[model samples]
Target: MSTDLEVRFKNIYPGKYFLSFSKEDLNTYLKFRSWLPGEEVIDGIEKAGESNMNCVLRVRTNERSFIIKQARPWVEKYPQIDAPVERNAVETRYLGLMGEDVELKIQTPELIGSDTDNFILVINDLGGEPFSFLYEHNSKLTGEDCKSMMAYISRLHQLKPVNFPENMAMRVLNHEHIFHFPFIEDNGFKLDDIQSGLEGISWIYKRDKVLKQKIESLGKLYLGEGKALIHGDYYPGSWLKTELGFRVIDPEFSHIGHPEFDLGIMIAHLLMTGHSEEIIPAMSRYSSEQAVDNELIAGFAGTEILRRLLGVAQLPLKLNLENKKALLDQASDWILSGMIRHE
Candidate 1:
């Protein structure tokens, strides 16, 4: 062991558990796994490539370039903010489990090293465009792009769950199928916010008790339906736009949840975009192109709704509304109508 190893570790990561490796070492291990080619070139290294909610950096050695991703258990900006560290570990665990199962239309970063404080990943920077950028430009995902994404999602759900080591205990699959229970503990949900959100929804929330009931019922289906490994945050931003096709990244939220959780979140964001008429055609076209059960979509929608309200990461639609009451109301309606089973 190098006498100064701890000193170097402290210089790179302060107050955190971490693993650091040189490109030569990283390459040697890759060859041991028969994953690296012989003639790779080293390039200049650059630092920091963060966006929206992740911390990223690039390391280009003669061998290859890898993107290092770090997940902050607490809110990145707000240190006092706390979220589950298990979320990170869970994502890594799921990726390892899904190794042979993933059909990569979009690329996922290759994992290199993993441990408690943080993990190091060496991934292909496929130059994929961000989903928010696509939305901002009003560029609807072409039927082809939609096709690939849907196919990947379908394949993910199609995989057999029986292969996994039966001990993980994903009890969420039980009949109860709790929604937002873990997050509601320390952080309080404001009643006024609910009232404000309800009001902004233009009484649609109050008028649609049927939708609410549907959401509740679907929650059961969500937990009990076909089980598989999922890319927990299957959003546009997690994908790339290229001549080759969509390359995916950011599986930090990955786990064994409803396939609908992945599907509903994407659809909810799509619904939030464009006006009512535009949204209908988009949803219809997407539904036509993708093979899915409306009942399942409704169930996933319910999960999406609860996730928006209580999940650590908030949706962009809510952020755009600006007016506190109006945003809450719109989000409330979004869950009830867009994501809820009743809708």
Candidate 2:
């Protein structure tokens, strides 16, 4: 390694914003792992994804390559969004736990190293775009694909982990957006600013006491005692389509909560993208005995749909205002009545 690079990296503080792996750091890390020749050098660094809260980069060399992920104290894009830095440790913990399960290990990236103090996690890179890209393009998953995905997640929840530290920080952060904000009249979000006429629709829903009561009840269930270990954000953005199969990533929001939360979020995204075929069968594949309450699942999914529609964090969906309003109406119906629509 060059002397200048060594000096620059050696002095790196843990809380640096947009923390990324430099070529020297990557080379040194590889050499430390004995994966590189003493003189081998990294050729380039490519950004992996648009992570607003963390830095993810793919480092490549003629010999080998890997991904470096580092979490910062605050969101990179929106400085106003402050979060606990320890969430990185929580993610690392989730990865380690998943590593112990053979099925999840195959579906998850291989964890190489994790420095809890520095909030850095290094793991193998699964190369491909998010499954979301395909969904957005109107591509559908085959029956086998849906089964495989459902089976993979079933294996996770079936483990029923009980002795793990709760990732309360991430869960709490997500709870605000998913449950609290959508029902509040002035939750500090300008919905119309995101898309035209969105604020008016959001206003109508927020002012509905009946809808708010239904959603708040669901929110209470979300914050209640643990039911099972769940991938808190199990939407398409977290599922990557690799040559091998679907690879799940980004479990930062993981928590010991209702398993239905994961299933509900997944179904909600599928609904938004117009891929409504596998809803029932996939749910059946994942359900075992009376473990998951169908009504609770519907309620959670309903809140998820409404939150994504009216809340601050928006998905890159290609729906017109009328279509979105229709979805909102459907979501409101489901939330108010606890009925899931297969259409």
Candidate 3:
């Protein structure tokens, strides 16, 4: 039978309409879900996190609350940056994949409901305390937290790569942001606008022809097909601290690729955040089931640091320009040295 709400949703352009939602819009969206309480009004709905590619919100009622995430064609913060709408579906599949594993579920969020037509996903809201800010002050992470994160990555990598075409789109997008744009001599990212003197830090890497060529080679390796499933964007921003513990979020960039890319990116963030002391310990805790190429991992780590320092995605760091430059120099050393040994 035809209904008023059904007709309403049919008219609401799923892509553009849901960009910023109201309580009424959310109510209409959840009309068909069994979890929604009958005859009860929604209390409030608000955005949950800061994201450049998706709209993440928390919808609440007297009965319960859940997170609603929808991916858009362009970055929310920087509209010029184009991203695939299908990446949200890839994230849903990734959550489904991890949900299948008993241990992995402990370290990840559960998928509750999803609307593929709108590229929106509903998942259990793991309260909004992101560990990314911990990097701002050199906060120490417990051994257990470090171990759980790396172990989760290791477990995911152990799984054979599945055929998911949507993930490839994210991988290509990630490759461009992480490898290509950051090194361009005049690629047009105004780093100083993000922070005073930030642009000066990139002068060395941006002008170095040799470093650019080396980075291009790393980009090629990133584009190569591999067998392990990887959390393509395994950085501080994706890690959340909840009542349960540390839960990894945002696998929209997940893909079948070299496991080292994940490990490298982890170390890259560590080095940039002034947590290099923890690098060896974190690597040791990973204890991958498969053999890992240490040099390749170092190269990936260097590239990630380079990108974060100069690329469109910037981290909130409380470091002086001198310190930022020092980190950049260290990242260059890692890139040129191409060696990371736990021993």
* Number of the predicted model whose lDDT against the real structure is largest: 3
What are the per-residue Cα lDDT tens digits for candidate 1 across 1-343? 2435455445655676432345555455445544456665435445434354334656575665666555544434543444444445655655555454546433454565455355434555555456665545655676676666766666666655554432122334222223433123333444335434532332343345665565566655554534665676676667777667766666665555556667766665555443334334444444222355654665564445444533444444433324433433544555545433212
Enumerate residue pairs that collide in model 3: none
Each candidate: what lDDT?
A: 0.51, 0.78, 0.78
Residue-level lDDT of model 2, residues 40-87, one tens digit each, is 778999888876677678878776777888776556566456677777
* Candidate 3 lDDT, 136-226, residue by residue in tens: 7757777777877878888888887457553767778888888898887788778888888878767888988877788899899888877
Model 1 lDDT on a 0 to 1 scale: 0.51
- Cα TM-score per model: 0.61, 0.90, 0.90
Ranking by lDDT: 3, 2, 1
Ranking by TM-score: 3, 2, 1
Off by over 4 Å in 2: 1-18, 25-40
- Candidate 3's C-alpha runs over 4 A off are 1-20, 35-40, 195-201, 341-343
